[model samples]
Target: MTVTDVIDRVSFMDFEPATASFRDDVLAGLSHPIRRIPCKYLYDAAGAALFERICELPEYYPTRTELAMLQRLGPEIAALAGPEAQVVEFGTGDGRKSRLLLNALDRPASYVSIDISRDQLIREAAALALDMPQIEVMAVCGDYTQQTLSLPTVGRRRVGFFPGSTIGNLTPVAATAFLARCANMLPGGAMLVGVDIPKDIAVLEAAYNDSAGVTAAFSLNLLARINRELGGTFDLSGFRHYAYFNEDQSKIEIFLISQREQRAAVAGRFFHFRAGERIHIEDSYKLAPATFQNMARAAGFEPTQVWVDPDGLFSLHWLLAPL
Candidate 1:
């Protein structure tokens, strides 16, 4: 499971055309009356860099809160994950949070970090492997949702760690299905997950639409990615970033509003947008601890523990598959 092997695996998948087609589909969708795209694609190299900046923003509470919960509770989480367990992380961005557990675990036999961004996953996993040569590094370069994670069949225990309020991106139905998938993968074991607590509009809005505009830039970079990857002609200036709470949906909706009526073309498709029409980019669904636990229960996992931050902004949950 060398870093070079990870590159080869993804290279064999032929991503360029797939990404280009996805970009075209998104741009075409944006022109429709009900404009939207799955915002996960926004994490190309540049988008990843911009998101890192957004994480550091004072108003962005998810990253900081998750880090804090892990820092304080990681030892307890690690103790539950047996010494020889293989740590498989979904959406292992930069593998920073994973390292916190690695430091506390007696010694994980192997680490598998799955992410959609192939380059970032490989780079970070390789660095961790270099630092801790004893642990085997398996980098799966595919969309975490779609990829079939091949865990080390040899391990005594297979524990999955999905930290970050990332599960919030899914709807209740999707979140339940995803948790079920994790339970099916791990069987009778634990899965560590981070969830953001539902908060007031003031705090949630500030987190998404930060004053420094880093989040705004991160939202718009998807357009830049489309332009570069799909041979799209989108005037970046034609769109303005938007993030606000959709009170009815109970989620923060991120969008790129057309600043002016404009026409754009991508991948042989043309789109027309009216000024102020929002092309919804993403949704961050905040969870009440009870609501999240209920969802987990539906997915065949029982929430054994919840670690809340001092500010009550976020929580880390340890769920066990049905015995």
Candidate 2:
């Protein structure tokens, strides 16, 4: 098929959360005693671009490390997945890792990319469809955490891909629930997941608090997004990005700390912040391989294989869902 035909054949499904949803979420989250915001909101167009820069930072090793491991393990993963597979990827990002797997898979039949960022999801899915015309591509824009995924029936076997250690973004309870949902979605198939391994405090902390300040920009961009989209009056300069590895939690906790006592309005609703008060934005939980496997088993996935980097910095797991 021609490139135009490939693009035309690519199905685009948008289930993006509405503007009202964003307003409501912001108003409610800010109303809490300890102000907070969901990390998923940090992926507006600008925030997503900022995150791409974060992947290249020297301190951010997860992206590059995971990419390298996928390069080495692609063929093996493809072998286990077998032929005529339908690959459904969660949080598809820039579609870099999916390309590696699709190229290695034996005549893979279709690819479904589910991401919350609509523009990136459409752009990346269309480009992937154009580049790999033999496979069908479906772009889904929705929050997998909040909604049930409706996958198209095309390929023989469905293989789920969740890469870039994105699973770390969810709490343990949420991660297990999310995996259970994936199991329900891909029964009798398998899931290939990228997970971050707990490491030295310094390394984990540095990954989020990069020296180049891209991560900071990414965190602050959420407020900028609220201002542009929801009539928010947030002084981005008044808050500083803060991230640290919480050893007790085995996670990297990220927040935007108010430099001084201040009040900001989001959706015409005002909230006061005390000096040094933090708005919790994200938590990147680092789970050991065995711990993760146990969680997977609890979620109804049989953990069959796991690959760890030489330095034990990252892990890739192969989980099989019962029929």
Q: What's model 1's lDDT at 80?
A: 85
**Under the 3 Å rule for N, CA and C atoms, how many clashes does model 1 have?**
0
Q: After superposition, how far is residue 320 of candidate 2 from its true place, in Å?
A: 0.3
Please provide, for model 2 over 88-153, each residue's C-alpha lDDT reduced to its tens digit, 9 standing for 90 to 100. Answer: 999999888999989989999999999998778878888898789899999888998987976877
In model 1, which runs have C-alpha deviations exceeding 4 angstroms? 1-17
> Which numbered prediction scores highest in TM-score against the true structure?
2
lDDT of 1: 0.79
Model 2: ten consecutive residues of lowest lDDT:
1-10
Going through the candidates in order, what is the number of backbone clashes in each? 0, 0
Model 1, span 137-237: residue lDDT tens: 77776766565554545466778899878898888888888888888888777799889888889999999988898988898888888788887798999
Candidate 1 global TM-score: 0.93
